[model samples]
Each structure stands twice: as C-alpha cells, then as structure tokens.
Target: MKRGFLEACVLAAISGEESYGYQIVKDVPASMGLTESTLYPLLKRLEKAGCITARSAEHNGRLRRYYRITDDGRARIEEFLAEWPSVREIYTYVEGAHHDAR
Candidate 1:
C-alpha cells in the first residue's frame, strides 16, 4: 500500500510538468519520507511500468533526467483517487474497532 501511495505521489508530482529527481523529492511532501535512495529505484520502476517517460537534459553542464507523466500514469492517479472512499471506510472501521477494544 505504501509503495502504491508513493508511486501515486511521484506521478502526481510530475503530472503538473516534467521534473527531475531532486525536484520530485522536493515536490512530494516531506512527511511521505521520500529520499534519494528510495526515489531512483521507484522512478525506474515507474518507467518500466510505462507510467512515465524519462529524458535527459543538461543542467549546470551535467545530465539531468526528467520525468513526465504518461497517459497510464494519469489513469493511475485517478484510480487511486477512486479508491479513497473504500480506504476511508476501512480506516473508520479499524478506528472504531480499536476504540471498542480499548
């Protein structure tokens, strides 16, 4: 679930415009615990899944890979949004159960 959430967040970050690794890290909320170590592999996975496309551009005389969301990636964001109600329902049930136990 966390992985899926991270993927959705990353996709949303780039959904607005093309973005590079460091920018993506900055775009996603710090509370999400996004780190350089976690982001690269996740970017590769998203690329592999065809949810995003990567291209290289020179910035400060060095290559920077930027990612843009693909059609599938947008669909993924929508899908995650659609699932929110169900997730919320489960959370509510769990919270109620925990209070009952207490």
Candidate 2:
C-alpha cells in the first residue's frame, strides 16, 4: 500500500481507542509489515497534520505515549472508508486475474 494509504490504516487502528505505538504495531496486521521506524514517523506526521494527538502516561514505571484519533482523524477515516469500496473492488479484480493465471 502507498504510504498515504497506510497512514489511513494506522488512523483506523487507533479509531476504536487511544493506543501506544507498540500496541498499534501488534494490533495492525503483520501483513502490513510495519516497524517502529516506519510507524513513529507516520505518527509524527499525523500529529502535525492534526489527525491525531499524543499523551504521555505512566505505565510500569515508564512513560508511554499514546496516540488518540482527533475529530479531524475521524473525518479522515470516514472519508477513507467511503473511498475504500473502489479500492477493494480493484483488489478483488486483481486477485481474480492472478488466480486465472495459474
């Protein structure tokens, strides 16, 4: 997936509730094959974009920064969800083509 599209998925992962970077890494599919390096920069970009917010909380004697979706983020997610059906249809068509090649 493109970086911008993947960022939307990251936003979706946080939509249900606030979550830490590590938790999100686990929650999002391994197929997305995310890493801290890729994710943290995306998180920072989202924060800058006003799509998300970060708050630090004490946990296990350490401060963990949690990412929460903002109203803008919700709007963005809604937009992506609305746009996803077309993307899904493309994927389905591509997959069918790949299968026919076998």
Each model's backbone clash number = 0, 0
Which regions in candidate 2 have their CA more than 4 angstroms from the true location?
92-102
TM-score of 2: 0.82
- Which parts of model 1 have CA positions greater than 4 angstroms off? none
Stretch of 10 with least lDDT, candidate 2: 1-10
Q: Candidate 2 clashing pairs? A: none
Error of 1 at 101 (Å): 1.1
> C-alpha displacement of 11 in model 1, angstroms?
0.5
Tens-place lDDT per residue, model 2, 1-102, is 577577887998999999999999898788888888899999999999999999999999999999999999999888888988998999999999999999
Error of 1 at 44 (Å): 0.7
lDDT of 2 at 67: 97
Q: For residues 12-75, what per-residue lDDT tens digits would candidate 1 score against the true structure?
A: 9999999999999999999899998999999999999899999999999999999999999999
